[model samples]
Target: MSIAGQAVGLFAVTNVDDLLVLALFFGRGSDRRATWAVVAGQYLGFALILAAAVAAAFGASFLPSGVLPYLGLLPLALGVRAAVQAWRHPVDDEQPAERGGPRVLEVAAVTFANGGDNIGVYVPVFATAGPAGTTGYVAVFLVLVAVWLAAGRHLATRPAIARTLSRWGHVLLPLVLLGLGLAILLEGGAFGW
Candidate 1:
C-alpha cells in the first residue's frame, strides 16, 4: 500500500483511540454503547465509500478526478485534529456514567466525525486498489467492526480500562493524524497548494 493508502487504513482503524475517549468521558454503558453504535455506522459508511471506489475502479464513472484529493485533506485535518485534542486533554480516567443519549444519532455523528480522516485516506486507496479493491476494503471494514465491538464491550465492563484507552488516544491519536496530514499533502495529487 502507498503512504496515503496506509494513511486511510490508519484513519479508519485508529478510532480505537476515540473509542477510548468516549469510554473514558462517558464511562461506558451509554458512552460505550454510543461509540460502538457509531462504529457500526462507520463500517457501513466506509463500506459504501469502498464500494464506490470499486465501481470507479471498474470504470463506472462517478466523482471527478479533482474531487478525491480535496477529500483527502478532510481526513488529514481530522486525524491531526483528533490527535492534537487527545494530546491536549488526555483522558480523565473517570467512572462510567449511567446516562447516555439515543444510540443511533450519537453513533452516527461520532462515526461521521471519525470518518473525516478515513475519507481523506480512502480516495487514494480507491484509486490504487483498482477493481478488486472490495476484498481488501471489506477486510478493513470487518477488522474495524470487530475492533470497535471488542473495545466497546471492554469499556462497558471496565471503566478504568476505558480511561486508560482515552489517555492513550489523547497522546497517540494526534501524532498519527499529524503524520497522516503531512503524508497526504505530500503524496496526494489533490493538493496543489
Candidate 2:
C-alpha cells in the first residue's frame, strides 16, 4: 500500500476506540466551547503520542536495522494484553465519571491513556520508514485526527450507532492489533518466519 494509505490504516485501526470516546465527549458537551476543548485535548494527546513514537523510533535506530522487526513484539504483546483484558472485562468502554467535562486536560489524559498501543505500533513502523515516509505518515495521521473528530461528533448525534461501536470495538480491536502485529513481523521477516 502507499504510505498515505498505510498511515490511514494505522491510524484508523489504532484509534477506533478513541472515536467512540470522542463521541461520548461530544455527546456530553452542551456548549460550543466544550466541543473545542475536546478537539484541543485530542490534538494534545495525539501530539504527545506521536512525539513518544518518534523518540522511540530514533532510539531504535541505534539497534541494528535487522533487529527492528523484533520490536514488532511490542504490538503483538499488547494485542494479547488487550485481548485478555477484553475477555476479562467484556465491556471496557465505561463512560468516564467526568463525562467529558470541559477540562481539556481530562480529554487529553484519556487520549493519552488509550494510546499506549499506538506508541508501541508506531515506534518500529516509524523506525523502518525513511524520513520522508515518516513525515508523510505523520501528516496523514494528523489530518485524520480531524476526520475522526468529525466522525465522532456525528456518532454523538446517533446514540444507537455509538453504543453499537462501543460494544463491538473492544472485540474487534484485539483482532486488528493481532493482524497488524503479525503483518509487521512477517514484513520484516522476523524470526525467519
Candidate 3:
C-alpha cells in the first residue's frame, strides 16, 4: 500500500473503538483544561507508540526474516492481559470516577495500553517503508488523531450514543484487541511457531 493508504488503513483499524473511549471521556463533562490534557496525553502516548514501531521496524532489518513475525507476540500478550483484566473486573466493578476521570498520566497510560495492536500493525508496515514513507505515515497519523478527537467530542454530547458506548465499550475493547493481535500474527505468518 502507499504510505497514505497505510496510514489511513492503520488509523481506521486501530482507532475505530477508540472513539467510544474518547467519547466516554468527553461525556464526563470535565473542564476544558482536563479535556485538553487528555488530548495532549493521547498525542504523547501515540507518538511514543509510533516511535516504538518505527524503531522496531528499522531494527528488524538486522534480524532474520522469520524472527520479524514473532514480534506479533507482543500484541497477543497484551490482548490476553487486557482480556484477563476485563474478566476479573466485570462491568459492575467499574466506577464512574474511574471511568471518566482524566489525569494526563491516566489518559496516557490507557492510550499506551490500548495501543498494542497499533504497534503490531505498524511494525510490519514501517519495516517495508523507507524513511520518506515513514515520514508520510507519521504526518497522516498525527493529523488524523486530531480529527478523531474532534469526532469523539462531538459524539459525546449525544446522550443515546454516549450511554450505549459507556455501557459496552470496555467489554468490546479487549475482544477487539484480541482479534487485532490474531490478525497481526496471521498476516505476519507468525503462527509458524
Best by lDDT: 2
Instruction: Encode model 1's per-residue lDDT on 1-193: one tens digit a residue.
Output: 6544654466456455556434432332345556555556556555555555455555674755555445445445655655555456445556322333324443343444344445545556667765356466656565666666567556645756655443354444445445644554555464476
Look at candidate 1 and tell me the lDDT of residue 47: 56
Residue 44 shift from truth in candidate 1, angstroms: 3.8
lDDT of 1: 0.50
Model 1 TM: 0.47
Clashing pairs in 2: none
Worst 10 residues of 2 by lDDT: 92-101
When sorted by lDDT, best at the front, the candidate numbers are 2, 3, 1
User: Which candidate should be chosen as best, given TM-score against the real structure?
Assistant: 3
- Cα lDDT for residue 2, candidate 1: 51
Which pairs clash in model 3?
A: none
Question: Using Cα atoms with residue i matched to residue i, what is each candidate's TM-score against the true structure?
Answer: 0.47, 0.62, 0.64
Ranking by TM-score: 3, 2, 1
| Each model's backbone clash number | 10, 0, 0
- Per-residue lDDT over 60-165 for candidate 3, one digit per residue giving the tens place of the 0 to 100 score: 4343446545555554565586568657767764553224345566456556556756777788888888788889999999999999989988887677866655
Off by over 4 Å in 2: 60-100, 159-193
